[model samples]
Target: MPFVKTTWRNSISFKVLLAYVAGVGLSILLIALGAVALITSRSDILLTTDVAERTHELAGKLMFDVAGHPTGFDDSEGDRVWTFKSLGVEIGYRVLDSQANVVLASTDEAFWSPVAKSPPSDQGRFKFEREGMLMYAATAPVERDGTIWYLQFAVSERLMELLHQGFAWPFMGAGIVLFSLVLLFVFGACAYFTLGYALKPLREVSESAAAISPRSLHSRLDSKTVPSEVAPLVSSFNSALERLEQGYRVQQEFLATAAHELKTPLALIRAQIELMAPDKTRDSLLNDVEHMTRQVQQLLLLAETSEAHNYSFAAVNVGEVVQQAADYLQRMADAARVGIVLTGHTATQTPWQADRSALFTLLKNLLENAIQHAPEGTQVRVQCTADKLTVRDWGSGVEQAQLPHIFTRFWRGAHRRDHGAGLGLTICQEIARAHGWTLVAHRAEPGLAFCLSPPVTDSPSMNSSQESS
Candidate 1:
């Protein structure tokens, strides 16, 4: 589950989808706010229209009577105000003189206090809240008997609020919910199709890249179909592969040519040294020539094994190969006064995919390295199972810190030997790598063991059998 979450977190398509949804959701929220503002403004406009029309009607009715009286008004002539009050509209009204005195008023004194102190010249509409009710008021001037009188009509907003809330709240809430759900669905569908369509070319590029390997470095990416944003990276990768292929070819050629050129003279020198008298100096010279010759031979073998094309992979028996290598190295083991023992083979031959010549060279180097490191009268054991071979020497094992550097070319330990230039184990590791095997070194009970085995991908069944055995 943690791995799944990690993959989801790193997914570009998921991130893109989330970003797209957030952007659209923010836009929808802004639009919904604007819509709410519009609805509220429209409700206020409706309330104001009702107040204005009522103010105009009241002014027409009261203009003549108020002009004649210009004093405290009686209830008999207040026809519209009385009718509106009877109908429970909660409207209020008043008339004022030029000095802002209340000449007439509704029975509800609190309703008219919002506009009672104003002048006749202030003949316009206004709005305010009074006692928790939104009120809209309008004033009109009536010139009668040479006195300016202001007639005002104001109404509570309870009816408007009821009408607005009756429909608006449900509509806005459902609209927001429905819009969000629809937007999420639509955006998710569109993003899936869009990303899939857009990344199709990238998928093609990936598949083509996966087909390329170290053996096929000449293959190039087809940039024509790839997105322009990614073309340069693919081009750079191809250029790097080209450089690596050229460098590797040049190195292999140099090593092979140099080894061949030095072989003839080194052979002649060894022959001449053999014909000389058996003196200490002569023996030393012969040993040096033999070491030089061994180095040249290892160099040529390293070059040959380094090339991927040189491998001829087939199923080879591990037991048979170990016995052959042991037999060939027996004389050297005897000279070193080190006993060579081969054991740990199954009755049924275990077949593993390998190149015959490279496998032999790998075993030869390991056996020789063990023999060289083994103390006199100590035994070097060669053990073979289904897919593995190990060479363990009963000598002083390498220190734990220096074990990692054992396969490096020309690397020697502190307790050094006089013979090798340290290419033997390097060559062995190179061959194992070229054949896609693992060569691991671990400390044994009293010495060190170098184990060569095929990779799990190549020999799963054989490795299982070996482990069980």
Candidate 2:
């Protein structure tokens, strides 16, 4: 069974919208709870205040009645008790002497306590607990016959408790419902606006891309609808497409030129073979055929290098590549009478990640170019460093005026047109670009130096090797 790999997915707008919804919902819920609590607390306070006010008014009325009696109040008049019952509310009051004995009584026993303790303070409201009931009682002291008398009144607290519980659920439910509706509307509106604004640019990008094809490489995305945050990305994509189109055109031209060059040599070799004498000169014709074949192979390799996916890269030992290239070009170098010297070749190896074949071709081209241009007996020095390769030839250096055009395709230097085709330096530059490396040529004090350096890679421990040819 083959193992399947799963990619993690992420969406920025969805996450942001979800977070906003959650925050808004939580805030609404908290506000709803606070509103319900505040209203309920105010209702409770009003209920309590009403009850207190009514009790105080009733006490005042009773005091007025007692004071207005013609005989004034006497113990023998049989203490009067007044009880008022209305709207399921019962209030009771009694008068007592300083001995703490009840002088009057109320028939509403549920609202009055016979054994209720005296108030702690004089002339103020007091609360007392008795018989599993809570009582809000007020005591007023009156002077009669030079003696202090106490008047007390009480109303049961059960009524207030019932009132609070009665109104609680309805108000809480209404608050919750109202807040839920508000939040629902808010979230829906937010989602709509956010989705529309965020997806607008993406939709435009899709439309533009859909209308584009290989033939319409010049078409570009509309910048007006694109958000500022995404504009740079769109512009960069367009630029990259432009570069790809230009590369394609260059590649087409290269193929046409390569085909023409290769066809000429093949035709020449074939003609030479066909005209060979029947017996003796066959070997000489064969040599010419081999030479033509080598040239064709070289041209084919150059063509392949122009392809986008031609090379597979690996860590190559630069020293090994330079040694091989030098060995292959030894005879040509000897014929030119230009001595090749390899220096700074160390046992310590520097390995660079590159296409092995491409690197070999690049080194060979540089070496051959130097040999062809250098004066006789002048040594061409190849030097290697940890990250760079340098090839120097002690010969007639490149003219300053022609240096800029040396790497252009088919560009022949001022004094070296007959030596070979001028595609060597151009091919070397292409290889360097494909590998993300840098190649530079400069005139040294006595000759020319071609330097190549490997690009930096993410892995620090993976050292790069350099070779000069």
Candidate 3:
């Protein structure tokens, strides 16, 4: 029952099917009731008509016998009554005088009830109960020697009930069974096919939507083939996709244009600032200028990385890339008072096919970011393995909740920013993605660790190209 209730609540198709079945079943039940009542009423009317005719016939016979015998049962009449009783005909008869007393009866033991009072003159038939038995009676008036006698004939109520039940019960049972069978056959097929046909448009809409992606934003949902009820939703979704694509294109264009437009002026400003006298103020101004310059460079890199430019892949040694990145950041590491260590190096480390410049940029960003974030006098260890490299630092690690947001562009956590643009990790992520590699950050006990692994390639290939600075 609970399962049925839940299904009815959650499933529209189930509810629809149930509604149809319930309505049809209820209709069949009411129709069967009406049919049974009509049949029973008609049968009772016919039985009453037969009782009236039999009562009159028996009255005539009884009057003729009484006229010959004067006051008692005749031998021929008695024999006829015994024959009917032997046949199991359960018929009772009595003759009443003008005073309503039973003067004569067919039964010797007084099975026939005496008339308690005079019946209404218009009442030719009536029903009554006596002792534990129900009975139906038909009456007629007869003249015998100038005295009026009431002749009464009765039939058993139990017999009448048996006749009605015997006919009505089987007919009703068969009707219900036939209705259930027909309902199952007709309703099952209609529900299955109707629901399938109705949901086909929704299924098509889902498949079409699933096939769309960033590369295929131009695709639109086909409203023509969908149902009228769902076409509005598909139209709205297509409109939303159009707006999103336009907004994305506009953002990409703005980033590219702004970076290109700001590069030369920011560079010239830096060169001019460097020629000034050396002082604390000068140093502060120079630091700010350098920060701005780095931001612009990062912005340009972000724009380039986001585009659909084809990057050249090549065979590059992971150890060589790590060493180069660490060496290049030696000055920055020294400035931060952090030491860079290289370990786990061995011969026969397989060189995988990847973009050399992209790998360098990736390693450089990771190493620099770790060094910048690590405490002074702490070491950033660069560990190399068969197909992966990890840079571990000893500093306050990122909060567990902030880990996911670290890879997003320009996102900063609860850490000090020393002229950091917050794009370093994001850039590394993009480079790794472009080269078909994966970069993941982990919360090392002392600090954070970043791991890089190149995706497996089928063959060894070598090529070289410079990355945009």
Candidate 4:
């Protein structure tokens, strides 16, 4: 089984998306802390205002003068003070004279101070633990007719506790979870969209670059729309393609020019051998010259067929093309004592879409190959359908190992008896591929079968059909 590879995990977009999500998580944490701080500040202000006001009111009722500091306040004001302690409101007060000595305190010593510690000298409200109980305490200066004294108040820490436990904890915990999810989702979507929008130009450049072949060497990737970070790479790749195109053009020109340059000398050689050919040596020399000439022509043809733009596609009559190839090679087949057989109705009825001359070249090469290898007195069968063409010959097929390289240029495989250039099947494959077809070679029990058709996953059956026939 082929491994299906996925690439998103390796992409920059995925990495950037993860980075955005991480930032969002951190932002939520900072926001949570800030919210708690703001709520704590507002809560403290409300507690302090109420505590200070009550302390001031209770101070006005008592004398600030040290000499007039009364410990026995048997009046309505004192009753109100006792009411708070009796009802367990946890509010306590201590009035101090000029020397910061406590002149009066609430009835319950345990509520104000269990230990004999001096009253808190600090002014602003604050929280502290006394005898394992949390308390909010504040001290403020009280004035009466130019005499200054200190009044300290303490309250139970329950209100602040209630604010945290009742609202802050539950709300913050839920808010963090919900806010994180929403932040990740929103930021994730935005990141993906940004990635797509940003990389679209690179995709266009890639697609255009993929289409650039030797035929399209003049084309260049457009760097204007690409991101600055990627533009240099694209420019370098385009420059590399320019150098490659120059080299490739030189190579192709060398093949064509060499093939053309050798033609006249080969022709003259063939003429000289033909003029003297009556003896066995002369005939053998003429045959060798002929074979060399064919190889030169095949080289020339390969140079032409290798370029995809050279093929002009049209609706070619498949049957007619096959008949023409068979007729053209009939003399050669007879010389080898091999018979040519054609099958299928589309041999006369046109149904295939292909390049006509290229198809003719393909069929000519295949038939010549089959004829050259076919055993004497045996038939080289040609089958045609609306969709495919098959050529099979009854001769010893190549080894299974050699079959795979049958179409490789100049690899003649195990066909040592052959004298022609190995470019016959190579040209056929180029033509077939240019027409979007597959030229597959299958080993027949007695010979080899070549199938020219569209690509298929199950090539074994389609490829070996001629052998079964």
Q: Which ten residues in a row have the lowest lDDT in candidate 1?
A: 460-469
**TM-scores across all candidates?**
0.68, 0.45, 0.57, 0.71
Superposed on all Cα atoms, the candidates' RMSDs to the truth, in angstroms, are: 10.7, 17.4, 12.3, 9.2
Candidate 4 lDDT over residue span 112-150, tens digit each: 655335544555566666667666767777665566677
What lDDT is obtained when candidate 1 is compared to the true structure? 0.77
Candidate with more favorable, higher TM-score: 1 or 2: 1
Q: Score candidate 4 by TM-score against the native.
A: 0.71
Instruction: Judging by lDDT against the true structure, name the best candidate.
Output: 1
Better by TM-score, candidate 4 or 2: 4
Encode model 3's per-residue lDDT on 1-469: one tens digit a residue: 0111234467767787777778887877787787677556655565677678867877776634545322533447454656345623466777776666667765543455443465534448876666667667788877777777777778776665665577756777787878777887787788868887897877788787876654357779989888898899999999998998788778978998998999899888888888999999889888998888889889888777655354566567878888888889999899989999998744426786676777788889888888878999899998887767789999898999989988998886555447678798898887766555668999999899998775545222222222221
Instruction: Provide backbone clash counts, one per model.
Output: 0, 1, 1, 1
Local distance difference test, per candidate?
Answer: 0.77, 0.68, 0.74, 0.75
* Residue pairs with backbone overlap in model 1: none
User: Cα miss at 1, model 1 (Å)?
Assistant: 27
Clashing residue pairs in candidate 4 are 319-347
